[model samples]
Target: MDQDRGYNNYYSSRNSRQYEESSNWRRGNVNWDSQWPTDRYSNSDYYGYTRSDTPFNNYNQSSARYEEDYSRNSYELDPRTMEFDRLVELLHPKFMSEYLNKILTFLKSNNTEICFPHIAPYKEAFLVRIASDHKNLECPAFDETCQNISRSIRDFLYKNSKLFVWSHSYESGKITKNTADTASSPNVILKSSSSDAIDKDSKHKQSRLKKKQIELVSTDFKIQAMKTILDFIKDDSRSLLQYPDLSEVQANFLYTLLSCYDKPEDGAEKSLLLTPLVEALKIYSLKYQFRINKDTNDEDCRFITLEKTLKGKSSENNFNDSLKSPSPSIMDYQDLDDWNTDVENSDATDHRSDGVPDFGGKLNKNQRKLRYLFDQVTTDFKMTVLQKSLDYIEDNSRSSVQFLNLTIHESRFLKCLNSFPLSKKSYFLIEKQCVPLIMKLRRVLEP
Candidate 1:
């Protein structure tokens, strides 16, 4: 009876465990495909596919679908988004100061995280953090958006600040004078005769006259302005080297003044009338010692001085000698003719020969001839020698002056001549006479 009770107790326990497993399988609450299978998997007839048991798989698929729908639906932005983009477009990162206040206002209202991506998208977030830190605002956490915006703003401020400074510097450089002094200056009054009738002509005629008067006054004012500028330049205390732009401005002003005078048809006539201007230019040239051929070594001036002295001495000598020489009289020529006639008559009379004379006759004749020949030889030789000496003296006196003049004239010819090469003789003659006079005149003019 006790053995039977033991067997019955063991069988009842086994049967109870099987009943619990069947109940769990029927409920289908556990995932059979999961690595840790429950009682449902141990009792299930299906091996792999079971819809009721794969809750984790269903959850994952639903999450993925929700993510894809969220991504697609949220992508299509409205007009408001485009309008915000346009507003941001107005802001240039380089010149951010001009739009700084506006940007700050917009940033305060908008989520900087959203706008930050679009604004200053290139700079690093750390740089943006700096600006935020300076302003005592919450730092746009270090990211690409913050970095780009900060850098762009900084660069913008830097460039515009420089431009502003440059403009102020330029403005400061402009000439400024007391207005009271200008106002206090005396005004000129025009005096017209009572008898001078005012012509009330056509409106166009009056306008034309007024325009011409304005033009004339403007020209005079410009001339005075140039003179003022030149005076400033000439002031020794003024350091033009320090302010090179001043010189450039003066040059441009002078160029404009000259351009006003340059009329195509009357250019030559205008140039002729610019004597005062030419004189001013010459004065400027002298003051500056400006030359196309700059002689820094001072050789040209010394050579020119020596040349002038030699030329002057030679010219004076020639002039004095010319004055000293006696003028030839007509009687001197008559006397010369009479002497030649007398000698010819004597020679013919002495020569008495019918045919070719004997050697002794020839000798005797030759002796008379020899006596006459000897006397003639001595006289002719003495006169010829004296004449040659006088010629030499005259040539020497004139040579220097001629050489100086020739040089000057040739230079002038070279300047004026538009054709082929000049003849050597003509060039020589010009150099001998003209150069000396030019040099002397130049020396007299130099101060």
Candidate 2:
């Protein structure tokens, strides 16, 4: 019996030891709040996925671990694309190092504005801060390092913006560190006279490749801007008065893009698409406000009214306002003036920001015929809206349905077609000669 009791005590002691170890083991494993976690646990009681974009997940991650080239020029010392978490960590004003001030200075000098806020969609405010009141946009030039920085910020913008529609091609492809190291194998080259040529060629190729990729990404952003403008155009409740917050040069770029819109044939689609687009062209004309230099009716000779106002006076004021009036520097003003003369310093400005109408010198047939109508609208905008209802009264081509709708619509055109006793051809006596001329101006001449 005593032997049996001894065996029981030994077994009890062994069981106690095992129970203590098992408790410790369970405690360690319970902290896997993430399906995957290198540091074991998240703060949450329930473990799910340790999402990389958790506002502060890995906010303290070191940049050198991701990109060997984490410097001002914005070059990746290595080919490894920066991971998203690292970007957030680097750009976040609160969490970032002193280098953020350098970024702020560079952006400020270029008149770039970045906002940091609490409520942002997808936490974009922390990742990328871009937008500027200045008309000129200067991305990093062929300098791969500069563009590489632009590319990263732009990527953050590009990815977050995809919640809307069509969206770019050196998408810093995220991969394992081991994989990047393997993929970017060091070149086994001889230490010889030809080494210089080889390095130059390699650099040139890399720069070209990066440029193409970044430009493609920029194109995607521009496309989103175009779509936003289209939505603005269709909503008649909105107007150029509440025009999109774009610089005058940006407005011009959109104007050039507008002319290139592939208008569809007349149908429900035409009424839905082309008609509003036509109105947009008229409203958009406000941005392109300029007069032909009578001497050189050469369309190229057109001068922008915005030069003295937009780039000269207003830009200085805006800069002062942005910089909080810290003694405006002459050198900075000189640089700005240089920028004014050439609004776009990058290679992409081919006629887009040169302040020239995309339409050639010769006015289109409708533009020639309807000069008086549109010119009046340009000169006296408020009065010419009646041009629509007035034209409808005189238009023989107006469908019975169109005529009926206008009469009953309780619009500015209400009871405009026929107020009997006044001729059915009302408001027509003065411009009787225009019975044909008005019809001749039919190509987008209507309101």
lDDT of 2 by residue, 188-278 (tens): 1212224345446656665454334334434454556546656754554432222234443334433333443343221111223245555
Off by over 4 Å in 2: 1-93, 96-389, 392-447
Candidate 2's TM-score reads 0.15
Best by TM-score: 1
Compute the lDDT for candidate 1.
0.30
All predictions: root-mean-square deviation over Cα? 36.0, 27.5
lDDT of 1 at 326: 29
Q: Give the worst 10-residue stretch by lDDT in candidate 2.
A: 173-182
User: CA lDDT, every prediction?
Assistant: 0.30, 0.30
Cα lDDT of model 1 by residue, 295-321, tens digit:
111121210000112222333221111
